[model samples]
Target chain A: MTASSASPYQRLHVELDARRYPIHVGPGLLDTPDMLVPYLAGRQVMIVTNETVAPLYLERLKRTLSGDDRDVREVILPDGEHTKTLASVERIWDALLAAGFNRRCTLVALGGGVIGDMAGYAAACYQRGVAFVQVPTTLLSQVDSSVGGKTGVNHPRGKNMIGAFWQPRAVLIDTDTLATLPGRELAAGLAEVIKYGLIQDAGFLAWLEARMSSLRGLDVEALTDAILRSCAIKAEIVARDETEQGQRALLNLGHTFGHAIEAHQGYGNWLHGEAVGAGMLMAATLSQRLGWLSSEDMARVETLVASAGLPVTVPAAMSADDFLAAMRLDKKNIDGRLRLVLLSGLGEACVYDDTPPDMLKALLDEFPRA
Target chain B: MTASSASPYQRLHVELDARRYPIHVGPGLLDTPDMLVPYLAGRQVMIVTNETVAPLYLERLKRTLSGDDRDVREVILPDGEHTKTLASVERIWDALLAAGFNRRCTLVALGGGVIGDMAGYAAACYQRGVAFVQVPTTLLSQVDSSVGGKTGVNHPRGKNMIGAFWQPRAVLIDTDTLATLPGRELAAGLAEVIKYGLIQDAGFLAWLEARMSSLRGLDVEALTDAILRSCAIKAEIVARDETEQGQRALLNLGHTFGHAIEAHQGYGNWLHGEAVGAGMLMAATLSQRLGWLSSEDMARVETLVASAGLPVTVPAAMSADDFLAAMRLDKKNIDGRLRLVLLSGLGEACVYDDTPPDMLKALLDEFPRA
Candidate 1:
């Protein structure tokens, strides 16, 4: 099915001047072939996908852009979050060079957030920043990674430790792509969806709660509208503070805690969306303890996450101390101080530098029981 | 021993608006402490040097940058052309991130072309590109690598195969930086210097012939003026076309042949400068064979390189076929066709795509037996 232009998909643009991009979200945006051709610049196109999603929707997307001047190539990487490693990145770069790709080539990332991040980074490093298009195939990616130009492979020591802020030429999010997604993956995506509400748009959070059941059941209109709104909000925030300085740090409400869980559990054990879901709840739990959040607000976050079928608590295996230790090494950490993005309330967060030890201890203590 | 502001040196400006950089070259330029301040930005500067050059001048440069807010951190990598791999890049990135570097940080690359290339790539990759200053401590880096913003790490499959087109904030040359350089390195640097003459400045080539003995002895004025003029020429070419779309290819006159040699011989065995030196001779020889260059013009290139203590002929161990095979895999090669930068005359080069194989073969057969 082609994307319906009638869907509430607004184009959120990245302000990179001549190298700028647009994020298009709606039901059939993927079928809009003409929108992407301008940036291709008569260059060869490489669509990088993965196995799991390829069997589902890669063909229709490929058929959309089969034009006379555009010569398209495909390289499918192994599927999953764990594949975002240096080995994979090297493979992407090598494959592109071998294919006679030059400065005039465009890389299309066609899976989920993993493909988008790795492919975007590969484009950035390939001949030093080529144009990339994000055909984000997952909800987490459509709402998050696809919009921001943060691309990289994971280091053994840390996540996205080696990366670049490479912006993509355009982000095409087909809501139809979501129809083939597994229920668990779809729910995992809601974690990020809910995250937007808690961090930047509390009103979106309430809308999510009211329409939670319909979204969980995959209502096409609601899903596309939700994805576009999330993209627009994220685009505005990124435009203002492209780098995670002041306002952008708010976007990481659940990420500091989320990174610890992902790194501690080892990548791929829990989906990144799952880890962020738990981390978002932890942030809410800590906020309640700090008296910045009421017990009702914390419960509201937990109830919303639970309704979306996301895990709402930390895993029993990892000690809060280990989580703290892992978080201290986060690239976000300033000097020796552990900087965490704490919520002032729902729909707001600020970078909290040098949090008192007692507050950290109290927060960790709350992670186990509350 | 400070650089004389009055009559001795020429200042060439690289104007990219806010990213503008000044190329300061003259005798004793290293001792001019104030010249270092403009590129430093804030206070902290990290000096990335290599084992070969560190023992000689790292302390002097560090002392020059020392004051109240400006503290210098030094990282020394192993010496050799082969050390420009991604591993070295990781070490540099790890060092910078571990040191709590923010976006405002500046890096000073203080060695030869290898050190300059590696450090500049690191600065470009770290935190998604930072301001890096090139304090080229070798002749090759001072005159050539310092002026160009091409920064990258070498991949095993290809040299500079994975990189970005990042420009340095400024390039500072202390003719004194060349004093500690060994004979082989000094000769390697002149290969690139000779390129400027063969490609754009025939007068400069003739001047080199007349003062061959004085230049070999490292006469301060002659050396410094040559470096400044070479940079001025490169700065002009680069300002017009930073990316090698058109005239920029002219800069690769000897590099195509030299890269093939370096690839076939393995990178470290032939220094990059050494490879280029041999490559230039072959380029001139091809021009003469093509009947586009006079015999005298070809002889001038060979004699000047030989006088500078650089190798002016290909190694007999590698056949012409081996060199051709190596050149075909160069990043510049597209669709298995070899593109060469050939001299139109003494002072200009034009890129010729897919030169007749017989022409390349005949030049190979004539490889300097006498």
Candidate 2:
């Protein structure tokens, strides 16, 4: 562990110019006024959250941010992927206007990935962009979404079909917030954590293999280590390719297949992480067939994801044609060709644009009964 | 004139990295396919325009862009500032989705500032941004909005209150399009053309003074020179400060008051150019009040604006309090203090945040009966 992690907390820096910010991971970070208040660019702030998260954390965060001089307001939406729409974002805009928020006003996203994406996009468009801070209260958000600059609401036709690469001013991840996370949501977050290992860090995969049980048991040290490492990996990639013209596409390792599942089954039917877990396994099947990854390693990859309580099997009702049609609609596809991220080995991945259709079909066949 | 302008048309380059693009200013450009087709990034093109502009130019543009292999779509919206809303942008989004446009697909904005703003903003958000080209047909768009990377829809409370600084791949300015433009709209464009001269180019202002009659007569050469010089000046400023952190704010020499007028009068009630023309005079009044501009120089500025057929006086109905309240709501203000872009001298502007309230009050009183 680094020296920062050796203390009660860990702080990692995202070094993108002008947009450079810190991600602080520690216990009870939400209670620490110093972690969030100093990052506010103005006295006005709007905390955007969803119903599920609002009941648990909104009032507490409001209390922490409230003061005689500050103007703090809260805007809440119904909790679900269906709600990640332009209409939902209009509520935030209307609220900000009602509160007379200006260009210098800050938007603080105080929930999971949905809140973060919606609020980040709101800040990006409000007065041609405003400062925003991410208070990610979910493991999924802290480890993935909140660390990177991608933010948007979804269109009915696709997940994250609309968005911008608007980075947050800072990220405050309180590990204590994870205590309220449901098991399924927690497992969803681990899928992305495992992704960092699968894509760039072989050693991290080995480490995750050893600590899976501790993570499931809600061990604070394990959770902290997972989030810190995941954020560090994401921060590194995002800093290098903020606009995703190149290497950053590798971060979408399972997202093409995962998004297809989410869109096919209807968003929110399959939790994003669950679909990604199963999708990663499906991608591994293709990688094995292509001879980049051995069959044994592919099975091992499946086992790790399965052990995390994430679905390794695609839903039984979806046929190969169904998956094919959905995958073809992914935004990553260019000129009618599906570009996918496949494992070169257990700990390494690369984007491949020349995937054979037969191999994709063969891989989909194996997942149909799962 | 530069060698490029020696021909029947002229081309100016905006040199911002990656976002660097050419601004082509000339006559009869809409009749030429080479001016547009070469800049398209893909076979799929969505041309966004408005009702008034569509009847006049849409079919001609479509005819120029059409081919057996290319997929071209057109989205025509109601013509006015009110239609520049999130709901209106949703129409473009829906049209793109319905036609299955992808990341590589290019959006071509084919009208005035409103079309460019909405289309550019749609391009910025669609699939986290796709390539777009601007075919700015109006004078205001050619000189100002189309050159800078600002794109967005207006909020109910303010003009251009929601947007992104997403640059287009290229800008195609056809001075021939001005032949069909309404006299009022033409004058509105002149307001911005004069703005460039007022802010950074006294020599350009002198040139405009000599050629104002020719430009008002829509003489192709005069119009072309005015646009080419104006775009070059804007391009330089935009390249230096893509985001309005410092120098870029100087480009808003009259916008702080102009937006206030537009927002208070209800956007479209006062044309953007008219508001800006009057607002520039108001800013000049403040400059003179602060002793930065001599009374004689300020009157010359007002005379130039009046010659262009734009309002040089604030409307009689707006009280000092009304203008003050409206200006206070401007996004440029920081920490509740209005930051006026005041003329330091003829052809030189600077952002001044410490403008005395009394000076602003005095300027408003002067405009009540102009």
Candidate 3:
């Protein structure tokens, strides 16, 4: 069916000059051929999804993409964050080569953040980059990973240590896919949606607080609004700073501490958003210590995080030193100085490299543990 | 020493807007810290070289880069075309992380094509690309790979099937290194020099024809001039088509057939330039068959390739089917059509996707076997 006849959706563009593309958010987008067909680089399409997503949506996506003139294939990788490695991407590359796909081909990432990240990265380097369309199935991926064009696999040493900022031809968010999402996974995704508010939009945070129940209940309208607003904020930031030169680093609001948690716990143990949820609270707490946020502001952050069903405390086993060790290797750091995205106010995030070491250590040591 | 006092060098820019960088060709550039220090992105520097190149120039390079505030490290990988893989690049990332090298870190690729390609790719993906300086020591790399931003690793299925077009901060070519290059390797470098002539500059081809022995004998002036001319032609093409949208494909005149030969023989067996040498002759012959070149024109290509000490035949074991199979997977092809860069005339090339299969099979079937 054509987009005109399909269910109504909100569209936003990541304004990247020549690489600008649209992100369409609505239900049943997976079954809409016109939404996807135009953005394809060529007739060859490789659908990279996880085993978890294939049974539910693969055939439908293939049917939408397949035609006599097109050669559509799929590589169903094993699921989870642990599988986000170069080895899995290599599998995608191997499959592309095995099928004799050329530079003109397009890769359709049809799963969550892991699938999208791996597939986008595979496309980024396959024949020095091919076109890729992000079909983010998870709520987390929809509101976050799919829009900004940051793609890569995880390293044993750190999260997203190796990757590229390759923009996608388009992003098709089929909100209907969230029906199969697990409750914990859904909560994980809400963490990022909440993140948009904490980092850039105070009004959105208030709106999210009011609609938290609707969001958690999977109210289609609430979820759609959240995704739209989140994408709008991210797209603006990415357009201004596509490669994270300066302002873009502010998007990592809780990522530095969150990465430390994920790395310390070992990836795949703590969901990225869960770690971010707790890490955001940690940042808020640190901001409180630094006089950037008031006690009431920190309380509000804690309440919002806890209400979203995300952890608001640090992983119990991690120590201040463990956090420091991992944070030192974060991609945001430079010249051996730790750079972190911290809130100057409820909605004002800033990248600061001057977080006093002693103060940071105190906060990490005192932060509540799960 | 400064570039001014450091044995005068020729410098050219790869005009890529904000990403534009310079290519410096001269002797003793490795020892000139001023040439490299200014291009570095930050204080952390990681030099990625191969075992072969490490013993030869690693110390000299390290001494030049080391300082009180700078963190200079090295990852010496096993040397060979076979070592160019994601696994090797991972080692570079591993070392970078171990050293806590952040996004501000600069990667110095101090070796030939393999080391440069792998290091450049590692830098391209490390923290979504850090700055990299190409210090290509081999003749072929100085004239070809190092100048262009095309960096990648080989897959068992195809050569350079996985990679990126990440530009370097600068490329420093120290001609003095050629004095230690192996005879076979020197000849291999000459093959690419001859290619610049066949693909774009007939005048340079004639010059090469006249000074082939001088170049082979490592006459510094002749080699420097050849490198300069070759780089200028490549920079012009790359500036016009950084992503190989059109004009840049001309540079791959022999690479399609050359890649087939390399894939069939297994990588590392035949040097890239050696394969391209043979591949160029094949393209010239096919151009002759297609009525684009005179018989005498084809003979000149053969003589030039032979004089450069490059093979003028396909791998003995590869049949027409082998060539067809490998060439089919070439990155240049579109929608399963075999795109070959064939000579339209001496010093002129065009990407033709309409090579009748029957004619391609005939040419491959009849081409001489090494």
Ordered from best to worst DockQ, the candidate numbers read: 3, 2, 1
Q: Can you give the DockQ of every candidate in the order shown?
A: 0.36, 0.76, 0.88
Native-to-model Cα distance after best TM-score fit, residue A337 in candidate 2, in Å = 0.9
Q: Tens digits of per-residue lDDT for model 2 on A171-211? A: 99999999999999999999999999999998999899999
Candidate of highest lDDT: 3
TM-score of each: 0.88, 0.95, 0.97
Candidate 1 local Cα displacement, residue B117, angstroms: 1.8
Better of 1 and 3 by DockQ: 3
lDDT of 3: 0.90
What candidate 1 gets wrong by more than 4 Å, as runs, is A1-12, A26-44, A58-73, A243-246, A282-299, A317-320, A333-338, B1-12, B26-46, B59-74, B94-107, B285-296, B317-320, B333-338, B354-361, B364-370
| TM-score of structure candidate 2 | 0.95
Q: Looking at the true structure's interface, with contacts defined as alpha carbon pairs within 8 Å between chains A and B, what fraction does model 2 recover?
A: 0.73
TM-score top scorer:
3
- Best by the DockQ measure: 3
**Residue-wise C-alpha lDDT for candidate 3, range B238-337, written one tens digit per residue:** 9989999998999998999998888888888999999999989989998999999999998899999999999877777898888888888888888877
